[model samples]
Target: MVYPKTGSLIVRDGREMTYTHIQANQTPSRSVCFFFPGASYSFDRPYLYYSTMLFLSKQIDLVHVNAAYGKDIPDFETSSFAKRSAWISEDVKTVVFQVLDQQEYEHVFFLGKSLGTVPIACSLLKEPRFSRSSAILLTPLLREELVVADLLALEQNVFLVSGTADPHYHQPTLERIITSKPNIHRYLPQNAKHSLDIGLQVDLSLQVLQSIMDELGCFLDKSLDI
Candidate 1:
């Protein structure tokens, strides 16, 4: 299952950022999506892999950001939360801006999971240029005050998913977000873990995945007015 892609690189903040640009087949696409993977989650992960196919099927170009910290950037692991957030935000912005500068898009979107949600919540959501863009936050760090605060302030459409059993799923924070922002659509799977998988319940996990993809399809269609 090899999809056509163009590998590219960019230097940001003294670091070389590598990414893969996957264009949709057939007609040119007016929409583009940037994907930010979690610290340990790569683009080929189930959620992301299927989502990538979904976007391309809809004729939306995809940019997968390959970002990793810790070993490569030793100080990142020791940095304060604020500093870490800033670092992630900058890296994401550089890739997004560089891509956008070369072409124009009628619609821009972002899909991030876990650690990837940090940049979308803290920076991209607040940027004036992306005011009309939509975002999909998969298993966001709801326990983080900054992330939740920004989510509450979100004005554009966003799809957020998490599991109650996941450590990062904060009921109080999610409640506040729901109470504050009507633009954010949320999905919570009971007993599902961080990967949205039911422990030892392979069938149930697959069911959850189906539901997520279905909901995401509807969200994308609605957002694009398809």
Candidate 2:
């Protein structure tokens, strides 16, 4: 099912940057979650918005970020991952901060899938004012200098979610990552593959949603109070 998406306008330096959002109508939520897709344009379900809404429900507000919205799609592949990462950090993250900063949202959760994970993590770590934030990662990208380790230190409230069946995430290494991270909560679905397709099983979509809800219940509960 498609989410009830609404666009919020952000005007800064005479340039407009608007992020698309789909709010939960059931409960008034203080926390707003920014859900990022994987490598390609994941405007479709099972990745960015649908999974969030299906799993998160009215627990918190959902913001589906389109990393490729205004960019030149042709040059994306040729551009070095580092440069692309920089674009995300400088251009994309800046827009995110500006949009959220312009208005007041209770608590903020920066959630990402695959390639989209590090940018948000790095963005939050670099910015001091973004203390009121949390991050939930699915099929986390391993061994990026920017986002590797030290995630719990970035914010007081940080949550990391992943799948064991996911090819990208190292299940054994995940244990090590979790050991050091007391704040981060990791959930691994049995036989899950990647984001959206966490595992080779029946009703993978539902399991993915439930997994997210399990780790992020704290924020979801806060939404109830909001």
Candidate 3:
């Protein structure tokens, strides 16, 4: 089947998939995003990924990628969370290449949440194409290798953001370690957390996200018209 030049679609198992694509007027803007969903959920889920749409739509055209859990969903019931993220990264890498081809995006940007950060980071390290664009990491899970890989990134513009009172992790402390090591712009929201919405209140998270998106939009190619 021929792909349309406008909206984005995913053909998984030959099924024409309707993705959560938000396309503004087709201007010369960077129209692609690598939305790496957290391990606990997929792209279509509201709480994890969808919750950030309000802030994202204003910045650029979007495509929310579902997490690939290999042959089955990752569970504490079997493998560790870290392991699942690794497996999903391979699948997500495949998806990214497919989308980049189908979407015909000029400028590429990355958006990864929680566990999604690691594998995507690794993929960028291995392949050179993804490194051409900026990376906006949301509440990432970092390891020694990820830190090492980050410094090796070909893409200079990196945005690292998280909350002060993150409910599930202590990544905020690690921010300082990586923040100055590279060309990273850091934002630890006044009181944000793992999810964009922390403390069960999304208002603060949403505000911070909007602020970040505004900055990103400013840098987007002016050709993608307002």
* Candidate with best TM-score: 1
How well is each residue in 72-175 modelled by candidate 3, as lDDT tens digits? 43352376654554555555666667666656777666677776666656565457665456666677664445444453453446666666666534554455
Measured over all alpha carbons after superposition, the RMSD of each candidate to the real structure, in angstroms, is: 1.7, 4.4, 5.6
Best by lDDT: 1
CA lDDT, every model vs. true structure: 0.88, 0.61, 0.56
**lDDT of model number 3:** 0.56
Better of 1 and 3 by lDDT: 1
Residues 133-220, model 1: lDDT tens digits: 9999999998888887788888999999999899999998888877888899999989889988999999999999999999999999
lDDT value for candidate 2?
0.61
Q: What clash count goes with each model?
A: 0, 6, 3
Over the stretch 1-226, how does candidate 2's per-residue lDDT look in tens digits?
3245555444323344456766675544565777777776375755554557543565566777665523545455577766666656665676577557655677777777777776777665567766656666767766554456545445455556666666666655566667776656667666666754544455766866766665566545543354
Compare candidates 1 and 3 on TM-score and give the better one.
1
lDDT of 3 at 5: 42
Model 3 stretches with alpha carbons more than 4 Å out: 1-22, 26-30, 41-59, 68-77, 80-83, 143-155, 167-180, 198-226
In order of appearance, the predictions have TM-scores of 0.95, 0.73, 0.66
